[model samples]
Target: MTWPLQRLTAPDPATYSPRQQAIHDQIASGPRGGVRGPLAVWLHRPELAARAQDLGRYCRYDSSLDQRLSELAILVTGRVFGSEYEWQIHKGHALKAGLEPAIIEAIRCNRRPDFADVETEVVHDVAFAAHRTRDLDDALYARAREVLGEQRLVDLVGLLGYYTLISLTINIFRVPPLDGGAAELSDV
Candidate 1:
């Protein structure tokens, strides 16, 4: 499905309302280099924009899970939800963060991905648990606790919840793939 809104022009800070201008400035410094579609829409809804920005900052920089593991959880959630937009966007970040290409492919297929170590296992376990049950069970909870510690395990769950929200929003909005990009499911 195509995205519903017109493709946004590169945001000019000077053209924004005061609140949106601040958001635009923050987006300039965000990880993806510029604010794209979901954010461009949120700019008109400041509270939601702020919430999204907070989620982005937390997931990308402040989450206790290492980047690779964090991304694995995200990919797994996207795959489970069949969110093409989320899977496509996060796959590149996951790869750049050192998730193996083979494992990323496996994630796209909704299989158990092979991981290099126990840290990766923790990510897969928590994601599988969350996706299947909408909550962790005793065995999965124990494993997560043993591997991630209380704080990081909590953060991991938060990250999964955050990304799942993002996936739902993007899918419901029919947020288009980045301009000129091939559709993710097409290749798969």
Candidate 2:
């Protein structure tokens, strides 16, 4: 796949610096079990890659939020950023995690998804508000806290911040989809 920018190169395991090599091994052995996407881009600076991989592991695998809510925040972040690579990476995971096709499609199209319950809608609202306005409004804050509880609310913020970082790396590096897929989103 052709990337928007040609300045960066993907990291090769064979050619990695010692620091990169160790980081690569850690990630390859962890839940992700392979290094790619933003991880590859960040490998240019092995230190950055190591720290990012640590945080990424926690956010993606060990978060307080369940898989469904985690995937929702990820997909919403992808949509908000138009991060095709991000969307392509998580859409299937979201579906497998039991996010409805209709809700996923709505988010893919940048519309409000018809959530099956208030909790899912609250997750969406919190994610969307964070991306769209830089902060959540008071009512939604109360709703998210009321529905998700304090721990989940904190995890939601962490998820949002992590995905924002993911989107930024994907967009700035012009990371291609894992499948080398073509563009899947455009300005509406």
Candidate 3:
């Protein structure tokens, strides 16, 4: 409620150029199954839309991290940014992906989640440390390396970076969840 931004109206499909339409099609028909959120905003620039969605596809699906970890990271990003739309969409995905409800609640409340799994704990620590301090301390870095291993560690960092952009976009555009639900980050 504090930083409510002016929301942009989605561009009419009829107004889309060939490139925009093509990119829209790519997004609408791809793994995401719809042109929504940041991709919807980026559609005004077809190339940006195309590239963003592609990167998003990789980050969301093809990354080395499993879907559970990925959703956890994304939920952290959404909570950190206080992005309503981001949190609203990913919260269910996080739960469905098998992230514990308690962990989700902790993140939603902006408190340290009590993760039963070290991987979840590591991800939360790494992401919170990175976002809050803008860098992971050596101890946390080593821990992440140990817990996540090299490739997943790399993917974790990538997921954080990409989701930062996503959070920024959602916040800047004041994108509401499709459901027009109440704000999830109100307490935070």
Candidate 4:
């Protein structure tokens, strides 16, 4: 499905104030090139923007979970939430992390993907649990703990919460899904 581009009414970046430019620069160097809609909103509020950038940095760069699991959790959450923007952005990252196309497609369709191994399964379970409940049952907790240590497990939960927040914001704002100029959601 094509998504519309939600054009910002803000002034052009070339004419931005020094503070705005700084925020823009921080986003540019951060994950997803800081061009994401949510981050763009944060930029309009400088203090919040800085804090958001720092959180983004920690989640994207300093998280204890490895890249593959991180991407898995993100993709699963995006898929479950039907946040097309998030799905569009992370699908490529998921692919690059060696996730199979079939698996990605499965996730996009909200199915239980066939994981290559146990680690991916753990990530998937955690994501499912996060969406399905606030508390993890004993079985789920044990499996996660067995696969990922306490620290990494906590980080995994944090990642889930972070992306869940992102999904909520983007969906609430109706952030347009990415379009390569073919068909716009606005036209649909």
TM-score of each: 0.85, 0.94, 0.95, 0.84
Misplaced by over 4 Å in model 2 are 1-6
Question: Could you tell me which residue pairs clash in candidate 1?
Answer: none
lDDT, candidate 1, 8-117, per-residue tens: 43345566788887777787687767777567667767668878878878987898888988888888888887776678788998999999999988877666877779
After superposition, the stretches of candidate 3 with alpha carbons farther than 4 Å from their true spots are 1-5
lDDT, residue 126, model 2 = 94
Checking candidate 3 for backbone clashes, the offending pairs are none
Task: After superposing candidate 1 on the true structure, give the runs of residues whose Cα lies further than 4 Å from its correct spot.
Answer: 1-16, 186-188
Best by lDDT: 2
The Cα local distance difference test for each model comes to 0.78, 0.87, 0.86, 0.75
Sequence-dependent TM-score of model 4: 0.84
Q: Write the per-residue lDDT of candidate 2 for residues 68-134, one digit (tens) a residue.
A: 9999999999999999989998999999999999999899888898877988999999999999999
Window of ten residues with lowest summed lDDT in model 1: 1-10
As for lDDT, the candidate ahead, 1 or 2, is 2
Q: Could you tally the backbone clashes for each prediction?
A: 0, 0, 0, 0
Error of 4 at 111 (Å): 1.2
